[model samples]
Target: MPGGVGYLLQHCGAFFIRRVWGDDLLYNSIMKEYIEILLLRGHNIEAFTEGTRSRIGKLLQPKFGIMKIILEAVLSGRVKDCMIVPMSIGYDRVIETGSYVNELLGVPKEKESLYQLLSNMNILSLKWGRIDISFNKAFSLKEYIGAHTTRRGIPLNPSTSKIDRDLLLQSLGYRILSDINKVSVIMPTALVGTILLTLRGRGVGHDELVRKIEWLKKGIEMRGGSAADFGGKSTGWVVDRAIQVLKDLIGQRTDLLEPVYYPVKRFELSYYRNQVIHLFINEAILSCALYATVKQGGPIHVQRVKINPDLERDCSFVSKLLKSEFIYGPNGLTENMMKSIEDLTSLDVMRIDVENGTDGEVKYLSLSAEERRIGRETFDFFCFLLWPFLETYWLAAISCFALIPQTLPPIEPTWVDERVFLDKAQFLGKTLYYEGDLSYFEAVNKETLKNGFQRLKEMGVILFRKVKKGNENVTMVALSLDWCPKTALPKPPKCSKTGKGSEEVKSNNTIFTSIFGGGKPEPKISLDGTDTPQDYFDETWRYFVPEGKLWELCEQIGRYRREGKNRRDTATVAARVLSLASVTGALLTESDGTGWIKKKTSKL
Candidate 1:
């Protein structure tokens, strides 16, 4: 797969992987046999420590299932003291990013097939850029166990203690993840993506972008990070190459008679941008906080202009705020922020003073002439990076306020399901997205939405409880303010019955719209007089009625399309309807199969 030989070796003549799916239960037994064969037969075994492909572009928290088995074998003396090595492989662009985005949005990932396998072979010809493979430090299992077994609170023999064994495996797994992050490479695609996106769709001219690239090269170099494909080249040359690559994927346009990226391509642009977000996110965050203090007239903005941030407090605040939006290594913000401060100091953007006291108060100062010029161009970049998350937080706060009644009354948190709250947040988030209040890609993200809820919870805006619903217990939230039981527990909007009585409440808008277009329609009319195709699309979704089958939904779409005169664009109409449904927190797959359904908009 790495070298693209899978396309040529159609019959798997010499190259083939014995796949062990992470989702399957019975595969555990197969995996055990596979491992035993490799260990005992003196064969090398390669495994993805992440257990599954990363859907969010960053390394997900490692699953301990496979790691536990491997550790068990070593502890049982089934294999000799094996050398454990951590390796990381990164691509400038991944082939599965589009499908990954869908899966992350809660769509069921389609099962892989032979036809799909052959279809993906087309990626071999694409300009995917370079592959970076980095090998990290190796450690032996014997040495690892020997060093960890005698920890103060751990038992002497892990075999006799399940808790001790589990802890040891978890610690080892985290170590491997840390090693993986250390070796990850930075690619030009990610660099370019970050630069363009930082502009927030306000396209930058060629000369200006090249200058920004030079500034980034210096910043990255100061942090001792590698930029792939940038070896020994002038910044202008590298920027030109990167822009050409982006143009190949998303066509270019001229804005104000200067070469600029197409703004509408930001979604695709964000994917590549996210690939390198981890490397400099902490630095960007620190810069923002300091700059905000200076701009907003704090002690830092005073005559001396040396900033003193409550290191632990400010860093943790920013980290929690951006946790969902950015991918970070295992290190906490405290440690990472300190490192960032040091990097910025070296870059001459900050300074640390120890002469006044031993605490080493950090000071922020205006950049040098050249540096100030760079900062001016990139100031909005920092603003764009943090704007969406701040908007999400405000949206969540508004939702909580709207849910609560004005009069004070005591109420428990168990009335509202946490899952339902998240659903509502995303649905309303899309509303805000359409209103131009939320970023395009961040609007539908579940994790970011969850972070918004969490931030509100921490701020005492909402309190939560665990409530038993059906066979499972769900986390529920309620306003921390006074509760009026009658109105506090809101239900889904009561949809009136229309059109067919016996069959579902599907609408026949042709006659109603034809008649109503020339006159005022009744208030209770299913098809509003001013309704356009978009309004109809929004209204038809309510017929989903919380849940239904995929085929049944398709049939409903067919009925709706048949009512209209435009039959030529059925496929496009069908896809748009379904996509809108998904974004609005209405459509989802059935638990056990390929069937699809809609989720309730509010509690009932």
Candidate 2:
């Protein structure tokens, strides 16, 4: 069977991408044993059955390549007692299923690609399931293949009977060699499907997830399927068995059973759940169908169609169209069409609703008689273009969102690094720093937001659908590109205001500034403002400082602001002023009168 043993070996064959066909690696002396093994085994004819990946428990409809090759061998009279017995060998676990799932989804692997190579290195393999090998009864080839070679189980000669051919193929499809219910797939799939479905759309807490899992055991029993059947654990034990399998698969923590108070482990639960998600489609079509609904989410938007004269006709038109398509388009208040419309109300996508009134005796309510419009796209026209495209991409979009954590290029410097300059990027759940912060430039907030849009578009995170909040705060600012090698955390600045970070700066301020400044001579301020490059000095200084306060000083003040909340202390103000004078020599000299700028002080 394709999904059986043939599928497992085919998976092995598929790993050697691009080295097949004309490549000598397979047929040549390089991997001669590998090729010989195939020929020696009845599977030597070498045709990969596509349907094996899905919809079957064993080898599927045989393709012509293997049959034709065998026929040629028979024609040349090289075959004597050729008996083909197809065997299905299921593994305890598929080691490299992350790739396997992709293949099933119609994304064939191109092994020659560099990105895939890098991706493979990082992939955490989920452990295999128990091996279940079912061998089909052997078939003799002499009578069938001697004179008239039957390909695809259909005889070629005009005199040959079609009825006989059909029976032969049907036997090949349905004959059970040795079926193993112990490792049959339905259990693993059903167990996982139940777990995920119970997850609903939100992540449950550890305690709650456990309780719900226990609840599922009873529910599954009530539903006429054993909760532990696919997973093949004792009754009410699937959860433990699954976790065990996952723990074994990951090979990270061997001690999985050590008090798993949570349904899954703290850090590793996501990985286990994701493994289930990987096989979601292949396991069961009903499960996949549930996933389809979950993929779309609750509803798009809910429109209350008022049953009116002209509007009724429009509603009927929409209802008829929706009904034809099998989307729930019931006439009353509870139609799925209205529910879909309701889903859009929360997320800020563009949409419109219209209403009109009539005289009291014949008055009624309904949707707009005129077609719904968004700029130029009518509602019907929009759904017409939208439905099929959404149907295709909706799964992709869900997986995109679900797999966001899995695929995220590991943030090079995870924490806020001074060298990296993005001190904090994540707050709560959403990304904290806007892309403009990384771009670092002097631009209007709008331009910064626009830059953020471009960068995020490249990142392919969320779309630029709508900006609900923080649009003003988000801006493009070139993050400090200057590097500071971290030998250790800097000592605190001795200054009254600055924190520990300022000490390193104060000790080697001149040397450090010179190195980073690239020999740009420090302005020689005369207090007279003569040839001072005060413009350059002031700009660079202003770039570093804000409102004449050094960045470090501002940081200290921020700390005080957080802890103190009120500047109620009198001495604190005076000490800070004196400390500023000590740091800035300009405070000591009288103003030259060229531009008299008085510095604030705690004038005691």
Candidate 3:
């Protein structure tokens, strides 16, 4: 469709591309020249849709320039019988992924020779699927016009027909889609790879993967694929061919095994896997926003349990950056973002290991300003415009039920969904309790996500169970690994600054929460010496876990301390127990077990 617009003079249509490569303005200029030529040659003017392709698999939002022209022209009687057709072309081997990654990384691609380009084709074999073109039944302009040609035409800028403009775009977009059947290489590979990754974490055999893929291809084929569209020499053959190409690459390199489907190109699997994840992520974003809108709740904010007691030191840096922008005041209107978020039942708060590589496969790894802006914008649109009849509102509530609070692992997809912490009901009698698990919050690749999970285990926030879904499970959403520690020291102060004066209040946020903004997802840390977030609490310690151990020691010595034992002996034992609870805090009293730990340690 991209080059087609460049070549087709008589059949002019809109050009949609991603906002990448700022040459879109030039593309419009070239199109206008070609269109003017065709009109001068007495050919019917084929109007253009000035739009861009989305880098992601979903359709890009259309620009209104072309739509404006079509409306003006049709109303002015500049054209007739403006029949439009929507066509889809699916690629079994997406030529763009290779090019796309290059573009994303700011890598400039060199145009290669015919042989070099062919060698890079990676089509060692391929299964090119048939193109799906939806021929929308044409409608006469008169039907929509609903008005006989007047000396003076209906006003295109009429104030009374504002809703009509929206209705026209929506109706036309869907009508055009009714004719498309093409599946691009990105879509199918994502479908197949996502399934395989889900089922076999290490990967799957080619034959077995193909069987599963065949079932899907065949099913879709039966639904709408004609004999030529698939089956013999069409989409099916192309898909089969694509898989075959992957299998054929086995003998070409020693590193490639007979069953190996890829050469392990640096970003291919990641790019494809991202395509798969984004499908669900996009849906999750849309649905969750809608769910939040109808529920009528306040904005959801999250906090992480602080392992480091150092207040004011580490957070001093983050606090500088931690700011809340008042984009606009909350109102009950469609554009009121805060109010829209307020309507949501819950927020998807995933607990990721910002300290580990938990989120590698995901493309954008951080909670950047751009992402936050998009998130707020998306919430606003869905809450205000989404049809109320849809189950988007209901589904949000149902999803929360799947999350068991406290024990949830903070995986990426788990984010944006409200997390419920499980109660420590089972440990009520045991005054001393301690537990931890690794929770990845950063977006990373498969390797990073795994590494992040393992490392997070060392840092704590551990959960006892794991839940996974789908075939390949690459898109597997994990619980945020929420947990509750028994408060051994029930009367302890609500907040304690590590190494600070006894009267100083610890800030509300902690080192981990401050470093990565608590509401964000798990972090993806790299093992290759990159992305190691500076740890402010690395040397500091929290008393929660340590206090738990102290409680048991207190119970063990309760009788001894209360007995008519020697005062010196009782003080010695009490000092030691209390010493175990102190972390970098200056010794206030001197005792071991019962007394003198502070005086002895300080003297040493």
Candidate 4:
């Protein structure tokens, strides 16, 4: 089957490799030998550290397999020295955007095939605006190991089965990914996507959108990031070109533009938006912290607001809450918060005051009412960047309530399969959007849900376990026993008729409770039979498989055959019975071994 293009690639030095999940001794030995030969022959090797393409445009966590292999080669003296060059490639449009959207929507990804490749060849004529590639200065692996050597003057050797060696590999992988993100170019499509998505279901005037694009470009540049060049073309031209490239996903009104296809296309737009999310992440965190302060009855005084412990604490909490989503520099959270404050002050959006305190010289942040009024546009820009992420986390928190039992102290904790939980979360998110309880539709994303799940686990609010189901190991989740729902979950925003301010509508409790919260009244089913609060949920959210019926049918078929009855006819009857039983739904109770009691059903 390796013909045509595959043959050409193989001839061009491409080789097949498989993911080594276990101790695949033979495969590992062959790969290690192949890599060593390449290094010894002075041939340059290129690898995608992430191991696979990210469904979202953001940089995925690095895979350490090949990296560890290369490191071992150098450590074993097979390769004298190897320079690691990190590279970043940005695209104006990704060809797989549509498939990525489908995958996010719970559609299983299709495996690659030659037929699909040939069918997609027509896309070669499509206008993909620009591709920007940047490479970071190469760092010598030998030198890095030498620099990190312990006081004992011992370099990291693969032969040593110590934790330090593993730590070194992890740190090295993160450094490479960080360097790649640093040099990533901000394309016009990414800028346009960020602006349009920020507006969210609203239309923007062409001139206004273009102005915002220019403003965002300036902000990125000010933050020590690069914007793609447009060959001296005006901002309007850049906007027009980007729109033209994305015309299918974007739509036009009289004099305004907006994203088409509602939530699905929003995922595609978010792909571009995530490319440059790192650039504005710090400002976004600060903006979220400031918003939280205002929501908690702490007014932002025009004169001054203390920034030392309180503001720093809030910022650190926000950063940690989103730690799974964004990558912070090696400087850590406090340092990054201070830098963001300095950046904001330099931009004249806020002023700083140095005050002599009992402990030391404390700093105060002040936003002059006059300055705020003048720079409202810039201030809103930063705050809007964080709205989607905050909304996503809020949705994720609310979805957890569905997993809890109606009783104050349940007989036993209920554990639901992780896949079922996320499916229910997505369904709940869509229902909320329709009912106006949720604002950002894009927040109902699969990737963000997974990331939020990881963050919740890190915060010790949720516990995960693996259980064997059928032939697969299913990941199951349950609320932590030590965690109380009443004090942990964020308060739900008031209904739409309340006319609450935007800040109040999205405001959460302490940053700790903000990402995950508990203690709300049990949700009620709507009056309409079509919608139920617990439609996707039950005492046990497990699917019914009717395994007993199928086995019984097999026994009957075997008995009929022994009695000299028509074996083929008996098997057909069993197949019909199995098909009918598969479609029947049944409620499972604690006595059925699910270990969770069902709440009494009631109409709203």
Return the top candidate by lDDT: 4
lDDT per residue for candidate 1 within 1-604, as digits (tens), equals 5345566664553434345354566767777766765677776557678777765556655667656767877888887667778898877777776676665454566877667778878778877667889888998876788788865454567666888888788778777876776667767777777787776335777787787777766656655566675678877787667666666445456645877654445655666765555566776666555544344333432512343444445446666655545556556666777787776667555655443546654544443344455554444455455554455554554445334432235333223456545555555555445534344545456655566677656755567666556776566666655322232221112223244322232323332233223344422322211111132333433433322232232232222111112222234343343333333222111112222233221232
Compared to the true structure, candidate 4 yields what TM-score? 0.75
TM-score of each: 0.64, 0.29, 0.37, 0.75
The lowest-lDDT stretch of 10 consecutive residues in candidate 1 is: 525-534
Model 4: per-residue lDDT, tens digit, 101-198? 87776667888878888898988987988899999999999888777665326655544755777877877888888889888899898888888876
Clashes of each: 4, 37, 108, 7
Model 1 / residue 512 / CA error / Å: 23
Better of 1 and 4 by lDDT: 4
Residue 551 of model 1 has an lDDT of 25
Off by over 4 Å in 2: 1-18, 22-68, 71-81, 92-130, 136-190, 201-233, 248-604
How would you order the candidates by lDDT, starting with the best?
4, 1, 3, 2
lDDT of 2 by residue, 224-314 (tens): 3232234444433544555455553322232554332323321122222222221211112111211222223343233332334433344
**Candidate 3 per-residue lDDT over residues 1-604, each given as its tens digit:** 2344356632554434344333477776665454444433555433323254333333332455544445534544554435443444444345566565544333345654556745757764445333333343555543444432231264443224666655555444433333332322234554454333333123455655566566544433433332223335544444445454334221122264645343344245333333333122222333333232223334332222121222112222111111110011113122332222223322322221234336443211112234345453333322222111111111111112222222223232222101111111111101111110001111112222232233323334232233232331112122233322232121211122222222331223342233335675433322111122111221122322333322332232221111111222233333332222221112112222122221211111
The superposed Cα distance between candidate 3 and the true structure at residue 412, in angstroms, equals 32
- Candidate 1 regions off by >4 Å? 1-37, 104-111, 119-123, 147-159, 230-237, 248-251, 254-257, 288-311, 320-335, 351-423, 447-604
Q: Worst 10-residue stretch by lDDT in candidate 2? A: 423-432
Query: Would you list the C-alpha lDDT of every candidate in the order shown?
Result: 0.54, 0.29, 0.31, 0.64
Q: Please list the residue runs of candidate 4 whose C-alpha ends up more than 4 Å from where it truly belongs after superposition.
A: 1-8, 23-26, 150-161, 255-264, 296-305, 353-362, 405-413, 484-604
Q: How far is candidate 1 from the true structure (C-alpha RMSD, Å)?
A: 11.9
